[model samples]
Structure formats: C-alpha cells, structure tokens
Target: MEQSLYLKTAISAVRAAEKIIRRYWDDGFDVRLKADESPVTEADIEAERAIRQVIQEQFPSHGFYGEEMGSIRRDAEYSWLIDPIDGTKSFIRRTPFFSTQVALMKGNQIILGVSNAPLYGEMAWAEKGHGAFMNGHPVRVGKVTTLNNAALSLGNIKTLAQGTGWQGLGKIVSGVNRTRGYGDFCHYHMLAAGQVDLVIESDLNILDVAALSVIVEEAGGVITSLDGRQLGLEAKNVLAAATPELHELAREYLRVN
Candidate 1:
C-alpha cells in the first residue's frame, strides 16, 4: 500500500474526530475516571468511535489501538494508533491545547501521522520519506546546533524529577537559551514547525507521542526515548531535538544513573 493512501486515511480519521470533539466542546459533557484516575469524557469516546469508523471504512482489515477503546487485532501487519484527544485534561478545562492524534504503524514502524487541533485551527501531518506539513504548508525544524542557542520545551517532568536524570534535566534547564513547559501536543507542533529547538517529556504513553515522532522526524528533527532508544510501543519518555548534534549532547547530560 502507498504511504499517501495511509496519510489520507489518517487525516480523514482526524477530521471525523474533530467534529465530535467540537460538538461536545460547545455543549457540556460529563467526565469520569478510568483505572489510572485520569479523566475520560463523552467526547473522547465518541471521537474515537468516529475516527475508528472512518479508518475502518478505508481499511477494514487494519488493526486499531485506541486510548478510549482497547486494542483490536493489534498483531495485524498494519495498525492504527488513535488518541481521540491527546490532552483530555485540557479539553475538560475548556483549553484549546487538546488535539486529535492519528498514526498508522506498519509492524513496529510508524509510516504516517496526522494531528488536528480543532479549536486552534492547526493541523500537521507527515509520512516516512516525505516532508512534514502544517496547515497545508511545508514545515521544518530550526537549525540551532548548540544548547546555549536552543529553545527547549518540557512536558510532564514529574517522573524525571524523581529519577537519576533530574540533575541532567536541571543542567539542560540552566544551559538552554529559553525554556517553556508547553506540555502535550502543543510543544511538539511548535518543534516540528521550527518554533522550538528541543522538547523533553519524562512521562508519556506511546499513544501520546507516536504521531508526534513521525512529524518531528519528518521535519528534520530527532526523537527518541530519554534513554536514547528508538521510539517504539515501549517508549515512556521523550527527548526530541532539532538536530542530531544537539540530541547527542543532551543525551550525555540525560544519561540515567
């Protein structure tokens, strides 16, 4: 199958999810807690349902691993990873930072991704070997090579603070030109569009960062776990940089004890 077809399907799925999310956003919805105590809402469920329907129509045989819904046929050669709302807490708080995330994974590799922030009116997508784009325009990461010249974004650093990498993170914070905690999809979007030079998150799920990994890499950036491993289902942290040199330098300070 061509990657363009996969990209089209992912975008269509994201659009379907956006409609459901907007409807609930305008009205009101009830929130509930899941096993992990994280919030879930009607919008999340309905959006995932809508996204899954769109993708299934395009490729019924493909598997699905969704945040709202559990995995189905997860071992299939091709699978879709869906996060109907990447920032559910933000959504519930009436913030526009939330987004619909969709990515197609062939075996262990992500082949394409689409991220849509409905209220923000921004969308980004990318495919392997093809360039990344935002709002229909091509995008790329910044060219900052040194930490002193780089702008860094941090997300979900609670776990990092409790680990051996805490000091390393402090060093990064002190050395960077500027830092912002633009947690969730917002920072990744900015990084891919060259608005930020690096992004770090010590806690996240694969569903939260899979689509983002594809976008950042396609935009001429490097993304991996804090441990310097390639992103896969098992990834728990993120250390994405605009250049390989910056990434390697950050990795040195971030090495786990």
Candidate 2:
C-alpha cells in the first residue's frame, strides 16, 4: 500500500475510536486496573475495538498491537499500534487533554501517526515523508535553539524519577526557561505544533510514543530517548526537542551517555 494509504487508514481508525470515546465522555464509565496497575476503561477497550474493526476490515492481513486487546497477527509485515486513550487518568477525570493515538509501523519503523484530541476538537497527523499538520494546518517545531529560551514540559515526577531520577530532572528543569507538567500526549502535540520547545518523559510503551514519534519528527523536531539514541518501540525514556543542539544540551543534564 502507498504511504498516503497508511496515513489515511490511521486517521480513519482513530476517528472511529474518537466516536466511541466521545460517546462515553462525562457519561460515567467503569475503570479497571490492568496487571501493571494502569487504569483501563470501557471507553479504552471499546475505542480500541472500534479502531481494530476499521483497520482490520481494510487491511485484514496486517498485525495489531493495542493496549487493551494485545496483539493479533503479530508476525505480519505491517502493524498497527493503538493507544485508545493516551491519558486515561485525565479522561476519567473528564479532562479534555486526553487523546486517541494510532500509528502504522512497517518492519519496526513508524510510517504514519494520528493523534486525535476529540473533546478538544483537534487532530494531528503525519506520514513518514509528509509534514505534520494540526486540523489540516501545517505545523512545525519551535525554533528555540537554546535551553535558556526554551519551555520544557516534563512527565509525572514519579515516572521521571524511575528513569532519570530527581536530580537529573532538576538539572533539566533548571536549565530551561520554563517548565510545566503537561503530562501524556499533550506535550508531544505541543512540541509538534511549535507551542513547546521540549518534552521529556519516561516509562513509555510503543503504543504511548509511536504516533507522536512520527508527528514530532515530521514537524522538524527530533524524538528519542534521553541517551540520544534513535527511538524504537522499546524506548522508554523519551526526550523530544526542537533542535539537535537543544537535544544534546538536554541529554547532558539527563546524564545519559
């Protein structure tokens, strides 16, 4: 299939998920804990199921790896990654920052990504070579070249401490002009839209970071782990920045070698 086909399919799949999410929004849904202690909701399961139904219909032979449903046809050359609700905590709290995330990976490399903030009425997407866009308008990472002028967004302190530790996070915070805990997929969208200059987080799975990886990269930013390594599904500690120079500077504070 063509690259555009991948992107279109991703968008359609997420929008299908968006419908289910919006239907359950503020209507009261049950939350259950996964084996890892992460929260899961009816919306998460149904939305992922909704996405799978759409994608599988079009590409029956493709693989699927979803947060709720796990994997199907895992050995297929083409795969779909789904995080039905990127911020389920926020979703359960009725916050509009939560999003639906979907991505297409061909042989381990993400080729398309779609992130839909349905409640906020915003959608961001990108293909491998195509540029990133928000609600059909092109977006790019900010031009902040120095940490002194950059606005940094960090993930939850507990998760950050798990990887880089408090001292390392302190070094990163002190070096930046501003810092905010815009946790989850919100900060990644902000980075892609040039609203924020950097974002660092830890303990991410492929479903958490895959879509944002392509979106941020296509927006002319770099997305990777704190160690400055290229991102793959296995990357846990993520560091996304507007420029290579800023990324290296942030890595220095992160103390990742």
Candidate 3:
C-alpha cells in the first residue's frame, strides 16, 4: 500500500477504535492492572482488536506494535504503532482525556500520526511535509517566544518527582507564563493545537508518545528528552515545546536543579 493509503487506513482505524471506546466511555468493564500497575480494561482490548483488524486486512504487509498485544514485524518498510487508549486509568475513571494514538514509522522514523479523543470530539493528524490538523482544521505551534510568556504543561508530575524530583518543575513553573497539569498526553494535543507552549513528560512508554512526535513536529514544534536527546521509543522522558527557546529553557531546567 502507498503511504497515503496506509495513513488513511490508520486514521480510519483510530476512528473505528474511537467508536468502540465511546461505547464504554461511561463505564468500562472489569478493569485490571498490567505488570507496570497501569490500568487496562475490556474496552482497551476491544479497541485494539478493532484497530488491529483494520491494519491486518488493509495493510497485510505492514508490521504492528500496540499496547494490548505483542509486537509483529515484517520485512516491509513501514510499521504501525498504536495505543488504543492512552489514558486507560483516566478512561476507566470516566475522564475524557484518553485517546487512541497511531503512528506510521519507516526506517526508525515516524512519518505520520493520528490522535483521536472521541469523547472530546477532536482528531489531530499529520503527514510528513503536509502539516498537522485538528478536526481537519490546520494546526500549528504557538509562538510565545520567551519563558516569561511561555505556557508550561506537564503529565504524571508525581512520577516525574519520583524520577528527577519536582525541583526542576518548580523552577519551570516560576519562570513560565503559566503552569498547569492536565495529567496525560492531552497536554501534547493542546500543544499541537497551539494552546500550550511547553510540555515536559517523564516515564512514558512508546505507546504514550509515538504519535505525538509526528503531530508536534508537523505542527512546527519540537520534542526532545529532558537531556536534549531526540525522542524515540527508547526515550519517553519528553521535553516538548512550541518553539526552540522554550525547548532550550526546559532543557536547562532539566539539566540544572
């Protein structure tokens, strides 16, 4: 299949999973914990199945890696990475912050991504060089330009404190225009939509951020680790910003106290 066809297939698949997810939005069935203590529910499995079926039927030669299932790789040049419900704990608790994230990667680099927040009724998608869109409307990065005017957002702050300590975040909040904690990748969505300027994440799996890298980059932003390394499945400690200045400031905070 062509890149466009596979991308369309991915968008359709995420939306289809969204439908199944919305069906149990109010109440999920029998939540459980993964070995990492993260929440999972029947809804997660159903959504993954829905997405996997789409990929398998339409892009049989492509590889797949998803949260609910193990990885499958083929000799094909493209792979689809998926997260049926990125915030399952929140979803199980009836929060609307959860999303279905999908990314198409080739040669170790993501070229396309789509994120669907069904309950929120919005979808953000991007293709290499084509730009990003939210609900089909074009989206771009914000241009706060300075730390004093920058909006700083975060997810899993408590976990961040456990890993590197909140002192870094403390400095960031004091230096930024505003600081808010939305507690999931939704902040990244807000970043892609140009609502927020900076987002620092700590301790996430690839499923949490695979699609986000493509969306933010396409939206004219940057996503690197706190240490200034490029974001990859191996690096979940994300430090994302709407502009280069904010990224540098955030990186300095991470490097300092």
Highest lDDT: give the candidate number: 1
| TM-score of structure candidate 3 | 0.93
Task: State the weakest 10-residue window (summed lDDT) of model 1.
Answer: 1-10
Summing lDDT over every window of 10 consecutive residues in candidate 2, give the lowest-scoring window. 156-165
Taking all chains together, the TM-score of candidate 1 against the true structure is: 0.98
The clash count for each model shown is: 0, 0, 0
- lDDT of residue 122 for candidate 1: 92
Which model is ahead, 1 or 2, in terms of lDDT? 1
Clashing pairs in 3: none
- Residue 1, candidate 1: Cα error in Å is 17
Residue 141, candidate 2: alpha-carbon lDDT: 96
Q: List the candidate 1 regions with Cα displacement exceeding 4 Å.
A: 1-3
Put down candidate 2 lDDT per residue, 166-192, tens digits, no spaces. 677787788789999787888999999
| Total clashes for model 3 | 0
Q: How close to the true structure is residue 22 of candidate 1, measured as C-alpha lDDT?
A: 87
lDDT of 1 by residue, 83-102 (tens): 99999999999999989999
Q: Higher lDDT: candidate 1 or 3?
A: 1
lDDT of 3 by residue, 1-257 (tens): 13477678988899789878877875547888889888888899999989989888987888888899868883468888889998888787787888899998887888898889888777888888888888888899998778899888877655778756477778888888888887566888899989999998786877788888888999999987778877666765788899997888777777722
